[model samples]
Each structure stands twice: as C-alpha cells, then as structure tokens.
Target: MTDVSSPIDTRWFYALVIAGICLNATGLFTPILEPDGALYACIAKTMAQTGDFVNLYAVGRDWLDKPHFPFWVTAVSYLIFGVNTFAYKFPALLFFLGGVIYTYHFVRLSYSWLTAQVASLILLTAFHGVLSNSDVRAEPYLTLLVIGPVYHFYRVFLGARFYHIVLGAFLTGCALMTKGLFVLVPIGAGLVLHWMLTNNWRELLKLRWYVAVVLSFVFTMPEIYCLYKQFDLHPEKVVFDNTNVSGIRFFFWDSQFGRFFNTGPIKGAGDKFFFVHTLLWAFLPWSLPLYIGVGNVVRSIVKRIEVPEYISLGSGLATFLMFSLSGFQLPHYLNIVFPFYAVIAAQFLVRLKPTALRRWTIAQTVIGVLLVVLIVGVLVVVQPARQGIALSLSMLIAVATFVFFRNTTLLSLVGRMVGAMLLLACMLNLFLYPTFMNYEAGLAAARYVNEQPQRAKRITALYGPSTFGESSWSYEFYVDGPTQYVRDDSVLQQLAGQRSVQVFTTNIYADSLQSRGFDVSPVAVFPYFHISQLTGDFLNYKTRTSTLKPYVLVDVRK
Candidate 1:
C-alpha cells in the first residue's frame, strides 16, 4: 500500500543480505541437537553410509514416520561433505536460503521492493528460522517447497509462462513428499480464498488446474514407490506393534488425518492455543507486529476492503488453525508458514505512520536489549567458562551492531528491527546454542568415547532399560558405531566377561552394574538436558542444577 519508494542503495542491501547469510552459516558447524534433530541426522548418516536410500531405518530398525525427500537431500550433502555436522545441516540451510530468495520474489511481485527485502530479512533472522538451520529438520525443506509452489502458482495465475504451472505442481508434489498431503492445505487454501475474494471462481475450474493436480500426483510416485517397497509390500513386518500395516495407507491417512483425530499410533494432547503461544517466541522480535498484522488482515477481509495485492492470509490462518486443532503438534511445524507471516508483517510495517513506526521500533529495540541482557545473565549463571571467548565475541558483536544501527537515519524503522534481529540471531547461533548444546550429554559422551581409541573400538552397549531416549541416537551418531541395548543387568555381566565393552548408561545404572560385581570405570559424566521439554526452570541457572540428570559412560570389564 506504500506507493512511495525508498531510495535504492544496492551496495547496502547486498551487504545486509550477505551479512544475513553469514549469520545463518555460523550455526552450520555447531553440534547437531538431540531427540528429533539427532535422530534425523543419524537417519541421514545411516542412509548415506549404507547407500540404501529407499528403506529408512532408526537404530537399525524399520523407520516409517516421514517420507524420504529430506533424508535424500541430507544424504547427498553427507556424500559430498563427508558426514560432518556441516554436511548434515548443509542441505537444509541451502533450502532455507532458497526459501528466503522465494520469499523476496513473492513479496516483490505482490507488493513493493522495500517490503520484499524486509520480508526476507525478517524470515532470515527469525529465531526459529536460525534454530531450524542448526537443528536440521524437515521444516527447512518444507519451507522452501511450500513457498516455491505457491510462487510459481501465483505466476501462472498472473498469466505468466505455462511451464510455471508445471513447475508449481512439481514443487507441490515435492512438498508433499517432504512432509505429507497436508502440504496442499496452505497453498490450496490461499488460492481458493483469493479466488473467492476476487470472485474469480472460474479460474479454479480451468483445465490447467487439473493438469497441475496430475503433475503433482505424478511427482509423488517416487515417495509412493519407496513407501510401498519399504512397508506396504512387506505387511508381515511389525510397525507400531501392528503387523500388516500399509505404509501407503499411513502416508495418505494415518500421518495426516489420524494425527488430527488422535487415532494414530503417535498421539499427542492437542491445545488449541499451542501455536498461539509458540508464535510468540518462534517469530521473536517480529511477533508483536505479526499479531497486529494478522488482526488487520482479518478485519480487512471481513470489511471487504479492496487491496492491490493478495497476501496468503487464508493459507497462514488455515494452517495455523489446522495445526492447533491437531492432536499431535510441534513448534517447528509453524516454520513453513513463516514466509507468509513475514510478508504480512512487512507489508504492515511499511504502511505504518512514522510515529507508529517509531513506537514499534522502540519496542523492538527494548526487546533486543532484553534478549542481550538475558544472554549475559545466562552466561554468568551457567558459567560456561570454556565458551568464554565465544560469549565475549557474540556480546561484542551484538553491542557493536546495536550502537552502529541505533543512530542510522537511512534505514526505516523496520530496517532497525532487522538489525536487532540479526544481532539476536548472532548471539543465538554463535554463543547461546553452542552453550546450550554443551549439556546435550549424548554428544559429550560420544566425543569422550571417540577420544579413547580402545574404548571407541569396543562394542558399545547402552545398559539399563533402553538405548532409545534423549541421548542414545546422538551418541550413536557421533560415535559412528553400533550401540546394542542391553536390557538385563545379567547381560552386562556376560558382556564384561567376553570382550571390551563401553556402556553408556545413567548414574543409577552405573552404580547398579558396579553392585552386581561388574567393574564400571566412569569415563565421563555429562549433564543431560531434555531439549524438547525445555522450560523456564530448566533454563534458569538456579533451577538448572536441580533439573539436570547425569548421563555416564563407563568402561565395563570383568
């Protein structure tokens, strides 16, 4: 809606983009996180090493939760980059960057160049966006796939080349493969809403639309074949305690609708307001504006106010509601719709009056300052003395950026917010995440094991109840070896007598094995953090010690 163009400073814009890229790149080398991230990374690593791209395995068992697209991408990256942390994350970061590019183009087409650049910046520096890159999950790939199809479809809607239509459909299929059929909800909802609002229902009935659907289905065949080969064709294999389960059926129904209805094997308690709270943190520095933007968009739609361009308000709202209504939900699921949120928020900021913009800028600046203070407080409380240099450098950068950008007159109010976001992201990636991951006991234990040649070569056994938990996959992945789960304590005694055994277990279990006449030499003790269930108490220094559980690695021998 802002027709006034800001003077172009191509050099500055390029510098900003480059700076954002560097910020994102900073996290690529950090240790892979646990539970989901470590699990996915291990899956990718296993796929690459085994060269069996079709069958997915977790801890040497048939894994059938997700499709193969993301793993395939990461596996290819691992092949090229040699299976390090950087390689595991490289593909997702590239896809995130692609999503950024698509976000810029999408907004530029629908709005102004200023809005486009700001939108891209907002997305690039968002908290979850940066976290997603480091953690390495399906969200990064889904984000790119979701945006690519929508952008191409919009091009076809504007009477661009017909190949764009085919491209859109193919991208849609890729998205479906990356996630599931739910990928269609946002894009389809947006298009349908746009058509209804504009009273152009005939566009939906076009022959090309049908062709696009066919193209999308055609592209999904590979996923279908893989699922069929891996699970459907072998119904005798047990999955989720049920034999004769169909992978195709799960992909089409169980993965999506079953989760929604809470009838799937994987179930969760649904909270309608889960995403509402999630967005508050996930979109950090831009959350307030996004909330206001969503409200304004809804009001405009209801009031029938004609706007020059169509935003994906329908797609975003629909997807948000759908996720909120689902029995199984996670915070990262919101990442795919972040591009739309960025565009809407950017558009709103660009149209704001100068006074209002300044107010928002002050609010954002205060939030940024609070974030920096929080980081400092955390560092002081946690006393990660080993990471002193990293903490000092990150703080210095945040301070320098704040001081330099605080007085700039050339950039708009929103641009200053971008500067704050960049600073926060730098702190998160360079200092905060690295320090937080230090408590990931699995990685720490694995690193300890890898350092000792004899211990590393020994057949590692996870003693106690099970090897699958907060730390198992991360340890297994980093050690790059097989970890057998020895459930019974008697098996540990037998294992000690036979060969050199390295057992990763809890402090209690280590004591138990010692009591049972097994020699347990404590190799390393790591403070374990269940990352997914991170809470305020867990983060606070005063409460962290109480929350931490000790994970021990022991050298077991007769």
Candidate 2:
C-alpha cells in the first residue's frame, strides 16, 4: 500500500474539524421544520409523555411507517431534556458525531494516522452529512450504526475474535431495528466481498460467523417483539388504511424490499441516475476526487494490484448499486455509506503520485472557491434580516480560508474546503432558517396561544376532511395545552358548553366561521409557508410576501 506521510500543518486540520463541528451544532437550537421533522418530534414526544414504548403513535393514530429505535432514542432525549426543539435534535446530532469518530478510527486501523485525519474531515464536511444533523432523521442514527459495526466486523476479519463478532452482531441488530433488513446489505457486502477477494475461505467457514448470525437475530428481538405485539397480535388494527396488517411482515419485507420494488403501502418514483446526480452535489468539494478514486480502485483491482483491504470499496459500491436499482430512492438514503466513500477518497489522496497530487490540489482549490461564490450569491438573493451578522461571519470565514490556503498542502486543502462550506451552512443555520421561521405560521400560532393571559382556555385547531391529520404537528407539539382537532362545524358542537376557546386555522376557514353567524375575533395573524420546501420566489425577499398564505388564531364565542 502506498503511503504519503509528509504531514500537512496540524493546526489547519484541527481548525477545519472545529469549524465543521460548529456548523453542525449551529442548527441544534433552531425550530424543527414542518412535515417530517415536526412529525417525528411529535411521535417521540407522545412516546415520552405516554411512557408506552411498544406502539408508535402520530396525529392520534397508530403509526407504522418506521421502526421504533430512532423514536426510542429521541423519546429518551425528551425525557431527559424535556419535549422541545433542542431535545428533539440533540440525540440525532450526537449519533452523527459518533459516526465521525468511528470513521476516523476505522480508517486509522485500516491505513495510517494521516489518512484517517483526512477521512474524518471529508466525512464531517460532506454536504449531506452536515445537513442531516439539522434535519434530524433516521439517517443520522444509521450514520453511526452502519459504520461503527463495520469497524468492529473488520477487526473480526483480521483475527476472528469472539468479542469482536459479538460487538458487530449487536450493532447489526440495532441497525436492523433502526431501518430494516436492507441495512445488512452494506455491512454484509463489505465483509463478504473482502473475504472473497482475499481468498479467505477459512474465515468464511469460522464457527464465530455462524454465531454472529444467531446473535444478530437475538439482538433484533426487541423490534420484532414490538412489531408482533402491535400489529401481528391485533389484526383488527387498521394501518395504511388496511385491516389485518402485520407489522412483522412489514418490517422484514414490505418496509425494505417492498420499497425496493415500489410495492409497499408507500411508494416513490425512481430514477436509475438519481444518486448518481445527487452525490455530485451532496458530496460537494470532495465529489470530484471521490469519483476519480472509485474509478482508480476498480482499475487497480482489475489489474491485480495489491491493496490493503477492499472493505470500503466493496461496501460503498454494493450499496450504491443497490440504491440506484431500487424503485425507491432519496438523496439522504446514500448517507449511510458515506464513511466508506470518505475512506476511499482519503486513501486515494494519500497515495497519489506527486504530479497527480498537485493536480488534485488545484481541482479541490477551484471547487472551494466556486462553493464560496455560490453561497455569497445566495445570501445576496435572499437578503435575510440578519444581514449584518451573516456578512461579518462570511468575512471572518474568508479571512480564515485565505490563511489556510497559504500553506499549499493536503491538510490546507481540507481546511479551505471545510471553511468554504462552513460559511454556507453557517449562513443557512444563522440567517436563512431564522428568517424562514418567521413565515412558519404553526410555530407562530403556538407561541401566540402560549402567551395568552387566559392559559386555561381550550385550544382547538380546525382541519378539513382533506387536511384532517395534516394539521401542523409542530403547533400540536409546541402549544402549552392539548390541542383538539375538529374537522368542521363539529368544533362548535364540541365546544357547546365551553364559554370561550381559541381556534387555529387558515384564513379561509376563519372566514367561513364568521360567515356562519359565529362571533369570531382575530387574535393574531401569521404568514404561512412550507419552511422545508423552499422555492425561488420564496427565497427572494421582495417576492416572499406574495408567496405566503395567511394563518390566523381567533377567539370564538361558544
């Protein structure tokens, strides 16, 4: 194996690490975005409050879409920190950070200290990796579960230690519980392929390998037990609008393979090239070199060149291929395998011949510059309210990038790349999201109701039959009082004996109530938009107001 041991400045590497961490941490306190983030938070909040870990509930109904592990962890966070935005996001961020540490150790064990540092920086700075921390989804949890186990399993391959196999099996069970049977594809593919390529038939036949299979299933019993109790035992429970549903069947088959074939209760249109295009941007500054590195690995393998290990290549390519062929695909789905990609990219850079190394540096430098320019252009277009703060931070990041770039080493390149993207993410977390929150009517309405002097007043949020449970989950989560959802005039009937109540609804619904001879007095109005899904018009400050719809809180005399 080729090794480039000449060290880049240590200060430069540590600075980039700190900046990447800060960028990820910036979103910890921000309000959760609507639809998914809020929905997940609400489910976890329900779990924590009810102390029922067996069944998952959302919008007052039994939810079956995801496995219970991520919610379980989030529920624990809510128990410790209280049910709030920070509590919701804290655990996910910690899991991703754990993935970062695992990445460093895995590469260091497989290669060298210098190579490991580069791999750590690459994984930490990956665009989607950082974004996942803010989004706070199952992906963050998978980030740690997938890589950490692979590290231990690789150790097992080195010597087939009993404890190592046990550790690997444990994490594999957790990964299964977290996502589904599909996660094993990456973990198994990496190790299986490495054994095949190295012609290690003896390792494949080891007794411990069979023991691992049994222990993995043993560790997964919790998820299985929960699913069996919740769905398999109660066939009368309606899930996905169908009766006699089995959660065990869904967990093993429908949730993973059903989605792969687009035959599940939920489906998405697939594109063979979706991830091919996604990684081009999702991997950001590292994407170009990663592609080149992957191609080189394939070429070297074909030519019978001696390489240290095939774990990273086998794991990454197999998972990438599977995702590309699957009928369901999402950009974030690729995040589970990014650690392998980082290791591969780092190894390629470390082993580069000097002439090619200089070329790689130039390409990375140009990518960094373009990244900064693009971010600056976004800030210009958005013209966020926190313009002064965003401008000052951008300038400071610029100064830091220039200082790091002066060194002309691989570590310096890592610093420059991280610094550039750090500015972009910092602007997003600090400026754009804060401004977007201003337009999140649900959060605003919740705050308004919480501040009312009449704290004991009943809170009812109106939703039409079409929008029934689609009502803002964040509003339900953040409000101080339990929120009742009423579909129509039934709200009036439900509040018959009550003297006064506050209703949250869109302007159209508010108008309908007044037209029906009900005395409705508007308490507060908020501009409403889907904060997670941004459009060009909504990002433009001048055009933003025009794009917003109105949501209102009103007092209705009962």
Candidate 3:
C-alpha cells in the first residue's frame, strides 16, 4: 500500500475527477422530474416569456415560496437556449460544478493538495450532490453560493485581501436570494465556531465584519427591491391566502423561520432524526466514513487535542444539528453542507492509521460491491428498452474498475468504489431515467400535442372528483400555444365555445364529462405516475400497471 502521506498521481486524480463530473452530468438529457424541476422550469419559462424578472409567477399566479435567484438564472438560460429541459438544467449544473471547484480550493487552503483532490471528488460523487445536479433545484445554487462565500470569508480571516470580503459578501447576498436567510446558519456557524475553537474570537469584533454586513445588504438590494415591488407596494395583493402579506418580510423572515417553526402557510412534519437517517442513504458510499470522521473530530476536541482546523467540522455539524431540529426537513437541504462533509471525511481518510484504514477499506469495498448489485438489480427488474447499452456501460465500468484499481492501496480501493457509484449513476441517468420518463406521461402528451398544428390548439387540463390533482407542469411548459387549468364544467364550456380546445384530463373525469352531455373525443391515452415519488409497486413490472393511472388528452367540443 502507498504511504498515507503521499499524494496520488496527478493523472489518476484528474481521471477520477472527470469521471465524477461525467456521472453528475449524465442526467443532462434525461427528462426533468415532476413536482419541483418541472414546476421551476415552467416558472422560468413564464419569466422568459413575460420578460419580467422581478415577479415570480407559476400557473399565471404570483409565487412566494422561494427567492428569485435560480429563476432569474434559469430565465436567462431559457432566453439563450430556448426553454428546453437542457436549458432549464444547464445553468444549475454549472453552479454545482462551481461548488465542486470551491470545495477543492477550500480544502487545499485548509489542508494539503492531496486532501483537496479527494475532498472535491467526495463532494462531487456524494449521492445527494450527484442527484441535485440532475434534479436541478435551489440546492445547486445554494451549494455554490454558500461555499463560495465561505472560501472567500476564510481567506479574509487569514488576511488575504480586501476583495475577499467583497466577494464573500456578494456570495452571501446570492445565497440569501437562493434559499432565504437560513443559509446564514452554516456560513455563520463555520466562521463563528472556528474562531471560538481556535481562540481567535476577538476577530469577531473587527471593523471588517461590520463592513461585510453592510456590503451583504447592499448586494441583496435587487431581491429586496423586487420583493418590495411585487408585494409590499400592493398590500391588497393576496398571497398564501392572506391579503396583507409582505414579500420583503417573507424573504427575510417568513420564508425561513415560518418553515422552521411550522408556522408557515406551507408546513411539514419534522423528525428530530430525519437528517441522520437521511444521511444514511443520501450521502451513500461515504456516509459511514463521514460519521466516523465527524465523531473523531468531536472526540479530539473533547480530549483537548490540537486539531488542524475546525471550519468544516463547525459548519457541517452545526448546520446538520440545526436542520435536525427544524419543523421542516428535506433530503436535499443537506446538499448545501456536503462540501464541508467532503473536506472533513477526506482529511480523516488521509490521516488514517494502517489498522483503521484496513477496516474502512473492507467496509467500503463491501459497499461498492453492493452498489454494483443494486444497478444490476435495477436493470434486471426494470428491463428497460435500452438494456443492452446500459448493461454494456455497466460492464465497461466494472472492467475499468478491475484494471485500474487492482492493487491493495487505499487510493485504488477508493477508485474501485467510485467506479461502482459511477456505474450506478450511469445506469440511472442513461438507461433507467429515460425509460421511466415514458411513464411520466405528461412529456409524451406534450410531445404529441406539439406535433399537431398550433393554429387552434389551446390546451386545458381538467381536475375533478376522480382525479387527485394529477397535472403536469412539463406538459404546460412544453406544449405550444396557451395552456389553462380549469376545474369547472362551466369554464370548459366557455373555453370550448371560444376556441378549438384540447383538454388533458383523467379517463374517469372525461367519462363523467361525457355523461353530463359535454362533447369529448379521446385523442391519446397516457400512463401516469408521479415519477419522483417512486414506490415498490411501481417498480415491479407485474404490479406497475395497477400502480399507474390513465390520463387522456382529448379534444373537447361544445
């Protein structure tokens, strides 16, 4: 085995880095998943179409759930690339990659070059990291925005340059715009806890800290102004079923604290251990190592041992604890702090003793093998139409893992495990997603509608008793011409008299409409499911049909 202190060959390191990136990028061409990705895409499409970047609108109504940074960026991409799924996702992927770059440089500053490389790879291949790049949500933007500031702020702490503070503040503002004020939790915790642990708490009172605060607010003016224009100026505007809501207030307080306290218009049931168990799956391949590394750091601190740096530990663990205690929790929220986890885990692996290294080596190898088994199981059970190409790719990855990492060194084992993850990701992106997206049904319906002449094809989606609100934002975004969502028969009757209208609705709803003396002719039938929320019944080919509901795109006439 190679010495623990030795740096990996640059050639191998770069190859692994490239592989990690390619894995994340694999889903670039895959269809956007529903409920979030498509919803965001449609909102961006509305922004691009209207050329109004200030107000965020979804389904032709004001959207107050999130800040507008991601939408603004995506809107610009839609303007440039023309509102396709790639356009919606490309900018987000770039931001996530930017986060990866920052992670590398941050660790290089805190530790060694070898640690930096490993950390960046760990950040990239971490399950949620890869998933977020594909899912393409606020996390990608927050990941970059949050880490970019920390890197600059950490440099500022070391007396690097005045520009570091300026850049850090700018990023802080961007992070605020991305996910609201809760972003400050990790950034503040990192800087504050590091200073206290390292006996540099006096730096907290420096004049520069005050300058940063002012600059952060200065940079945040655009969001503040936009929110003020959209809601604050018009106090009569209804939002969240309340007419007196203020956008600026929501951006600063309600958007974050409301959710934390379960007092928001939107709320969720929180589990104190939600993130803990979530990390078990979401961190994947490296979750066990990360837990051990974090525990070791805490033990060292308790024993009064001198440690290398506390920034990663402070930021990662602090944010983790805060999320665990919040009234609302989600899997992707952890993606923001994954860079810190990568750095923490990487440093721990670099300093491992011979005995401990062997145990981890064995444990990680088992994990790698299991990941391979998982992909193989998916291929077998799903039996995608493109199974041949997917299997070929999986086998090719297996061969590469064996040939490149056959030695007994820790780096080689790491390479093999990463290969396992790469193999699984490739299967999911290239094979599984494309196949399952057919069941997304909305995209297929949209494609069908788009193929028809656009002269008189006004689209309307109906909702009624039998259907539990199955509508596709992907369809709304992709369909040519105007789309309306109507719930009443009178609204449909009025629309049918006004134009040649096509309604995308459930079979049961159409049947009821027909019996009520409305003219409905079936144009196409689509198999539908909420692809993001997968279930075992949906996965098993035998029970898949029962799990699917039928949605019909029909031409309605008065």
Candidate 4:
C-alpha cells in the first residue's frame, strides 16, 4: 500500500474540524422542514407526551411505517430538552459525531491516521451529511449504527477480545431495529468477504460467531415485542388496506424484501441507476474522487493485486448492489453506506501514485473553486440580509483558508475541498433554509394562527382532498392546538354553523368557500412545494414561482 505520510499542520486541521462542527450545529437551529422532519418530530413529541412507546400514532391515527427505535431516542431527547427542533435533532447529531469518531478509528486501524482523518472529514463535510442533520431522519441514526458494529467486528477479526464480538452483535441488533434485517448485508458481507478473500475461512466457523448471532437476536426482541403487542395482538385493526396485517411479518420480510420486490403496500418508482446518479450530488466535491477510488479498488481486486483492507470496498459494493437491484429506493438510503465510501476514498488518497495524486488534487481544486462560485451566485440571488455579516465572514474565512493553502501538497487540496463544502453548508443552514422555510405555508399559517389572541380560541379546520401530504402534516405538527380535518369540499356547509373558525386550504378550494356565503378573509398566501417532490425547478428562484401552487389560510365565520 502506498503511504503519503507527511508532517501535518495541526492548526489548519483543527480549524477545518471546528468549521465542520459549527456547520452541522447551525442546522439544529433551523425549523424542521416538512413532511418527514416535522412528522418525525411530532411523533417523538407524541411518544414523550403520551408515554406510549410501543405503538406509533400520527394525526390521531395508527402509524405503522417505521420501527420505534428512532422515535424512542427522539422522545428521550424531548424529555431532556423539551419539544423543540434542537432537542429533536440533538441526538441524531451526536450519533453523527459518533459515526465520525468511529469512522476515523476504523480507517486508522485498517490504514493510517492520515487516511482516517481524510475519511472522517469526507463523512462530515458531505452535502447529504449536513442535509440529514437538519432534516433529522432515520439515516443519521442508521449511519452511526452501521459503522459501530462494522468497527467492532473488524476489531474482533483482528484478534481482539471476545467482548468485541458481543458489542458488535449488540450494535448489529440496534442497526436492525433502526432499518430492518437488511442492515446485515453491509457489515456481514464485509466481514465474511474479508475472511474469505484472506483465506481465513476458519474465522467464519468460530463459536463466538454463533454467540454473536444469539446476542443479536436477543437485542432485537424489543422491536419484535413492540411489533407483536402493537399489531399482532390487534388483528381487527386495519393497516395498509388489510384487515389484519402481521407486524412481525412486516418487520422481518415485507418492509425490506417487499419493497425490494415492489410487492409492499408502500412502493416507489425505482430506477436501477438511482443511487449511481444520487451520489454525484449527495457526495458533492468528493463524489469524483470517490468514484475514482472505488474504480481502483475494483480493478485491483480483479487483477489479484494486494489490497489494503477489504472491509470498506466489500461492504460498500455489497450495499450499493443491493440498493441498485431493489425495486424501491431513495437518495438518503445511500447515507448509511457513505462511511464505507469515505474510507475507500481516503485509503485511495493515502496510497495514490504521485501522478494520480496530482491529478486528483487538480480535480478537487477545480471543484472547490466552482462550489465557491456557486455559493456566491446563490448569495447574490437570495441576498440573505438577515445573516449578511455571518455569511460574509464565513465566505471570507473560506477564501482566506484556500489562499493560504494554495500550492500545497495533496492534503491541503483535500482541505480546500472540505472547506468549500463547509462554507456552502454553513450558508445553506444559516441563510437559505431559514428564508426558504417562510414559504412552508403550513408551518407559517400555524404560527400566524397562534399569534392571534382571538384566533387561538377559534376552532381550526384543515380542508383538503387528502390527509397525506406535506401541507397537512406540517400544519398538523406546527399548529398549537387541536386541528380538525374536513376532507370534502361538499362538507363546507357543515362548518358554517361554527361561530368562530379558521380554515387552511389551497387557492383551488378558497373560491368554493367564498362562493358559499361564508365570510372568508385570506390571512396568508404561500407558494407550496411538496417536500417529497422537490425537483431542481422547484428549488430554483427563477423557476420556483412557476412550479408552485398557492396555499392559502383564511378566517371563516358563519
């Protein structure tokens, strides 16, 4: 393995570390966006308030989509820090930090400290990593869970203590609880492939491996019991258009494989190359290097070249292929495997040939410059005056750092790339999201209603065709008090007898309410973007207005 060990500039490295932390931390202060972030926060809040840890409820109905571990963690955070955005995201951020630490250690053990630092920085500064922190979802928890067991099991394979195997099993179980049995594909594949490739097949037949499996099964009992009590015990309950759905069956098979085969109740239009393209943007700045690194690993394996470590390449490729073949997929699903990608890229960087290192440095520098330009362009378009000073200062720091490190070695080039991403993420967290969320009509309308003294006492009704959209969920979560849903426009007269009431509906329905002789005064108007269907046109300022429909909040009285 090629090693590029040189004296590190401690100050520069520490500055980058601090910048990464600050960038991620700023995301906590931003309002949780719809529909997942707000929905998950409300679920956690409900869990804390009602003390019902077993069954998940949303909008006063049974919710059975995800496992309970993330909610449990967030509910605990709510208890400690109160039900706020920061508290909801606090635990996930901590777990992300833990993933960072573990990634560093795992790479260091397998390679060197320099590679570890690069890998950890890559994980921290990745665009999706920052976005996931603010969005606050299962991915943050799963990222840490996936890395922890892999690290421990790798230690076990390295002839560490038996306790390492036990710990690895426990983490594996926790990961299974987070995402389901598919969590094993990456870690298990990595370890087994490593042993197989290294001709250490005896390690696979060890007694401790069986013990680890038992411990993993034991740790998973909590999730199984919760599923059994919630769904299995109540066969009369309707879920997924079925009279009686087996929760354990759903947990074990349907949730993972059903989705893979597109036979699940919840399905998405899957593309075979969905993740292949997603990483291009999600891993931004580092994506090029990652692809190159992964290609090198594959080539070396094919040619029977001596490999540094199989764990990263083995696990990353396995998971990548699994998701590639799965019938349903999302970009965030790729977040769990990113730690492995980081290690692979970092190891490649450390061992890169001098000519290849120079080429990578040039490519990264070009990307860094382009990103900085993009940030400037966004600032010009958005003109975040509220955060002007902070944004300007961050930009200055980033520019200064790049200039100072100009013409340095390969490490400095990596720093420049990371610094550029950090600056962009900081601006995104501190400026763009805060301004953009104002257009999140649901939360905005909720706040508007809460601010009125008389409005607070009035009954709030949300009128829409369906109850399963970002607007409904965001409004439900942010509205201070109970909100009733009127699913049909024909039932508008039913609410006419109410003395005081407010209704949130789209402009499409506002005409119907107004024509019905009910006094309707438009309180707030916002451009609505469905959170799940965010496309480039929807996000661009130039094209956003054309893509959005008007969502209106109105005061309606008899």
Model 4: weakest 10-residue lDDT segment is: 489-498
TM-score of each: 0.93, 0.95, 0.96, 0.93
Clashes of 4: 0
Model 3 pairs whose backbones collide: none
Residues 358-423, model 1: lDDT tens digits: 777777778877776776676666555456775767567676666656642325444555555666
Error of 4 at 463 (Å): 3.2
How much is 334 displaced in model 1, in angstroms? 1.0
Per-residue lDDT tens digits of candidate 2, residues 418-530? 88888878988888888888887888778877777685356565544347432368788888787766666766656744665677788888888888777888888989988
In model 3, where is the ten-residue run with the lowest total lDDT? Answer: 462-471
Candidate 4: lDDT of 479? 72
Residues 1-558, candidate 4: write the lDDT tens digits.
656586246676677777778777878988888888888888888899889898888765677888888999999998898877789899999999898988988987767667877788888888898889988899989888999999998888788998988888988888888899899898788888888888888987888888988999899999999999988999998898786888999998999999999998889788988989998999887888789899988898888887878888888889989999999988888899889999887777777677777877888888887887887777656655465775676778677767777764766777787678777877778887776787788878778878888776566787875555567667776677777777665455567575646788888787777786778888778677765455666556677778778888887766
TM-score, prediction 4: 0.93
* RMSD to native, candidate 2: 2.0
Q: Each model's C-alpha lDDT?
A: 0.81, 0.84, 0.84, 0.81
Clashes of each: 0, 0, 0, 0
Residue 79, model 4: Cα distance from true site in angstroms: 1.4
lDDT of model 3 at position 279: 94
The residue ranges of model 2 lying beyond 4 angstroms of the native Cα positions read 7-12, 455-457, 468-471, 488-492, 509-521, 556-558
Residue pairs of candidate 1 with colliding backbone atoms: none
Cα-based lDDT at residue 216, candidate 1: 97
- Give lDDT tens digits, candidate 3, residues 491-547: 788888865478887788888888988888888899998888888888777788998
Q: Is candidate 1 or candidate 3 better by TM-score?
A: 3
